[model samples]
Target: MMLPETLREIIIKSGFIKQEDFDGAVKSARELGKNLTDILIYRGLISEDVLGQLVAEYYKVPYISLSKKVITVDLLRLIPEEAATTFRILPFSKTEDTVSLAMENPLDLEAREFVKRKTGMKIDIYYVTAPDFTAALGQYKKNIQDAFTKIIEENVEKSIGKSGDAVTLGADIPVIKILDTILEYAVAERASDIHFEIMEDSYLIRFRIDGVLRDILSLPIAIHPAIVARIKILSLLKIDEHRIPQDGRFKFKIKENYIALRVSILPGFYGENIVLRILPESTRPLALEELGLIGHNLNFVKQNIRKPHGMILVTGPTGSGKTTTLYSILNILNTTEVKICTVEDPVEYGIKRVNQIQINPAAGLTFAAGLRSLLRHDPDIIMVGEIRDKETAEMAIHSSLTGHLVLSTLHTNDAASTIPRFLDMGAEGFLVASTINLVIAQRLVRKLCTSCIETYKPSEEQLSYLKNFLEDSELTHNFYRGKGCAECGNKGYKGRVGIYEVLEINESMRDLIIKRVSAEDIYKEAVAHGMIPLLRDGMDKALGGITTIEEVLRVVRE
Candidate 1:
């Protein structure tokens, strides 16, 4: 094959291949290496383009080096007229022994050499940027215009008017703009989750705004995998490994504000499904008073928190705002004099003046092992990440009983359920009663969008349900629901508020635990002692229009 002899020698000298290796191998292998091309292919040394050039060179045909040659009208003719016209190269000139061509990118050396050899003339090349070249192309400019028009038409048909205002040219589209628009809308709508789902013909984008899923936009399916990969890459999740589930977190800075994102990926039948949890940089902490505990109850809890001894348990189901409540209590109690230490699975937020340890089981630093070691540090306050097993729970309780004020979280549905959770972890009732100072249970409910809330008279059935849940015989006249509006993205809700149920460990409650009282009975006695249930806190928000009746019903219903 006639590749440029110089280029062939350059390749050979580059140590990419050995001539003896190719020749002997080709001669010996009858089926696999029948030709030099086959030998090169087997060795994976050169591409088809390079082989083609070699063949052209062996035949002594004109060879245009794309990398080193200048672009001229003759080379432009080799390109499809549609592409050449779109790029605006035209008007060739040939004199007796020289060709003077007016073309775009005339400095493209590959184009200049091809033209010089093909026309058999000395070449003079002129260079112009796009706009100047288009203007110089003159009458032949119609060819460029027609080519672009066809591309625009094809792109429009493919896009199916989904983004009418945006223009597309062939396979290349300005996708970043569309992503930005969707993100802006999501932020404006106070969406908690952004869903990008792939379909057969189109990609679907949806926002989980106000606890409801709403479709935002759609695009051609050709772009779905790319967009998905982009999101995965941004989240620092595995992009190339698609067989297993992965979790990742990332933060985005937009307009001087940072947004935290937690991404979870799982394999789906069609492709990977992703869920992005958007956590705003700023959020209000749930204070004890804001949690619907009366002043006396708050004072009691505060006194216990301030005691300098005993463990405080914050118990709730997942996504119940347990971390926020614990952090608030820690913030209240934190001071320069006290040495506070915390071990967390993943430290969500950093608190100044507190030493926080991130628990990594993979590194052999687990909650139980970390807690057992933390006791030696002699911290005034200790925070365990969670009581997943007996060892950690016992260690935390022992620390509290010894002298340190300990705080930790447990997975349970409510305050009363926490006792059983601890017991299930092999904690003795008497030891739990002696060590635990307080238990705070909480849940989050969507707040009614202030921009779109409307007062409404409750139906008898709704009123009856509310009275029974409140345990109040009287029905109040004031209640509200969210009315859809543009400001709230038509979801009638803006944000979320926490509803809490606090259980304080007083002498009577401790004695009841010692007697092995049933969880239901203990709850009843606590209610009698003026402990407000989570349902009441939710009701108060509903009555005040902080949230809607439907939201309270959804969160607090049995």
Candidate 2:
């Protein structure tokens, strides 16, 4: 009898059973019976070995056993010295031990553990060879490389096609293949953004991957307009209408994954300055704790944001991840109980539980106008894409004071800089102080790939720079740097993490704002009140191997 026969008997007794249901029965039997194999065999359902194999498969792990009938010293020697060291296997016998070893696979940790514990001696394990190990390893490596290459090519085709912005060449190699090579290279390098600039004779393509600009391959200038047009088409913008700047957005679906893209086009000296915001499909909404905000700060933000009134502003420069942060917060607060509405220039990501509006300024549905109309619908939480003008800023402030929880973005260097930015927009200090609840200034830095990081003592000049900057503060003597590896696409870095500085306005800060304090002065006070500067936050993450020092310097300096 076999385990399958036992399974069949159980099924027949039950009339019929699904695999999952049968597994449940097996679990119950194991709990109630002694010597599970013997019980099955006595019941005329399974053989000992078959029962053993079933247990192995059920656990999805290799099985190893050492009965005095099946241990061998030659098998122990067959395992590589490195493998033995890793597994902590000790050599015990000069000749083969007559211990029977039963395992689904030789490398099973549980099997090894069982043998070592039962035998009270070290066991050597050997795997069956299939003619050529080196050749197999080589083939596996090549397959991985080829798979990566295919993924890259596929991504390029999807992005280009999504944009509808590349000239198709009906040649042997699709132009998309070249495009995929370039983008895969950029993404693999962990670039923050991709830039395409047109010159006289050539189209210059560069990737701001990892906060550093690297020149990618260039194309002939003749194809510049075609590429631009292709992008315009993909974005759903009118490709022929180039007289005025046009903006559009669309998503690219590749391998059942979707990426959000925002395209902006403006007339340039040589051609059009086109910027594409490539938002990967895998961006998950992180919780406040995950964002590295301290306990007090996290509590403050969550408490205030969860309230029914006031405005929360997330301020940062272009490409500083303001939108992502906003979206993440929105996701946190989104529920069926509240009415949330957003007016974006071009909505970046879709939220299931909120009403989202895309601004069509071309048709006179400006942010201010949209907000005014949105007020009629009675939203509990209002998201203004950006307070770009005095009108929109005034509207956002007024909305906050009118009992709506307003969220918006402002282009400023730091949290305190939001004050000066509002002032520059003709927003009175009193209005700003009254409406503002929280301001989060953030930047994105490229994290170092942990799989390929190297640590060293700081250079004298680097130490001097740090000393000069920190003055009396303590500094770590050693720092880590990224060394390019296959895992990180030879870029040494992987992805980006946020360096955030959150400013929660209390009565004191509001008073300072009402007094029209300078941004630098306000920043000073915020720092004194335990607001971590973006640079310091970046440095902390760098030390933790979350990002590289070079990336921190590049973004913080900017």
Candidate 3:
């Protein structure tokens, strides 16, 4: 059965998907003869857990995530495997008179009745996502690590004494299987990036998990060349040319899901060092509010992006999620009536209906040139990936002044620094003051693991440091932090969230900019005008239990 419109409305009201996307998914579901839930999950418009939660909320049932749940053999024996498989259910826990069962379709009367009769106890039903349910069902079989060990052992023996050229060795079945297993393990561990480092005697493989790198496995240096060659073959790079750096990308699949891997290989002292950035192919741009834009910052971005003509600049150092913020804004403004064009150094993700151009400096199509062409194309909104030079900066400002909403990024420490950065690029004071609407500076901090987050009163020194930014801070206030837990791999952090400072250019700030004031002076003026500083925003989040003070300090300056 299809997802009811009421449940779709619940998801939309919860800010997970837009009305237009939901309607499109509904139409696509009809055309493809698939249910609405499958279409939404397949398209990555909404995650399975979130959709399941919405479904549970609509049905007034409990929702559960089976990711970290451990099901014992005795619990699995509550219901027959055939019945569980046929009904798409799992018996997770059991007591004397009650059994807790997780089901993908809790509304199915047949499944519930079958489960109740089989268990002969009061069944505590929990709604779970399809992926989670399927994964839970796999717990009935062999252990995941055991399966990996078997594959690795068999492959290592197969390649023990085989001698061949790098290309030939790479084409070997054992190397292929080993590489596939490594990739599968990385995906299973939710790695954002994979690093292959060559050493004198060995090759080390590490996965960057939650922004931290940990060694996964090591192999003999003998097979390093074969591994490199295999990666090059997969990414379609030249195997013979290891002296020069090469960049390429390829898609890797695990089950029904596909991951887009961006490959970067550089010649190192030992050998070629490879780094792969893992991006899910089906993922879409997240909503603004979901990007950790809370309260004022959230409201400010919402209001400013809707303006007919102005420039919004997101500033941060490398890997601070500046591109993500830009994509999110573009996602909001993307519509049929308003044509949005972008010129990126390398286009990251393809957004539907937005005209994207990759900047090819070797081909003479720089940001300035592409932007100039876009202006001739008569676009309502423009996105320049970065304003790296005076020419592109001028063009972006010109576009904003010429009745187009422009979004782009700059490499600056904070919101206040963006103004001075523009002036340093030779942008005039009046032009900088007039065309810019808002400046957002952000940094990503690891979020506290919710499953094991604990709260405690801050120390006197910590309280004093936090009070420096917040005036109304109290000494008795308790802040939250994540203790080590299995769910977070004992790191106390699971994911990341952005701490932002949004500076809205007003009359006084514009005047200060036109007068060419120092960045510090502009920062003070913006603070007086209700602009939250990055440290203050981070502290606010820490106080609210979203992250720890230490995590905030790790990224933002005190």
Best by lDDT: 3
lDDT for each candidate structure:
0.66, 0.66, 0.84
464-494 per-residue lDDT for model 3 (tens digits): 7776655653445556677755556667787
Displacement of the residue 411 alpha carbon in candidate 1, Å: 2.3
Q: In candidate 3, residue 173 scores what lDDT?
A: 94
Off by more than 4 A, model 1: 1-181, 199-202, 210-213, 282-297, 464-467, 470-473
Q: Each prediction's TM-score against the native?
A: 0.64, 0.66, 0.78
TM-score of 2: 0.66
TM-score winner, 2 or 3? 3
Worst 10 residues of 3 by lDDT: 137-146
lDDT of 2 by residue, 366-438 (tens): 9999999999998999999999999999999889889999999998888888888898899888989888888
RMSD, candidate 3, Å: 10.6
Candidate 1, residue 495: the lDDT equals 70
Question: Model 3 reaches what TM-score against the true structure?
Answer: 0.78
Ranking by TM-score: 3, 2, 1
Of models 1 and 2, which has the larger TM-score? 2
lDDT of 1 by residue, 227-336 (tens): 55656766766567779988888787766668777777777766766777787776545677665444445666788898889988887777666777788888888888
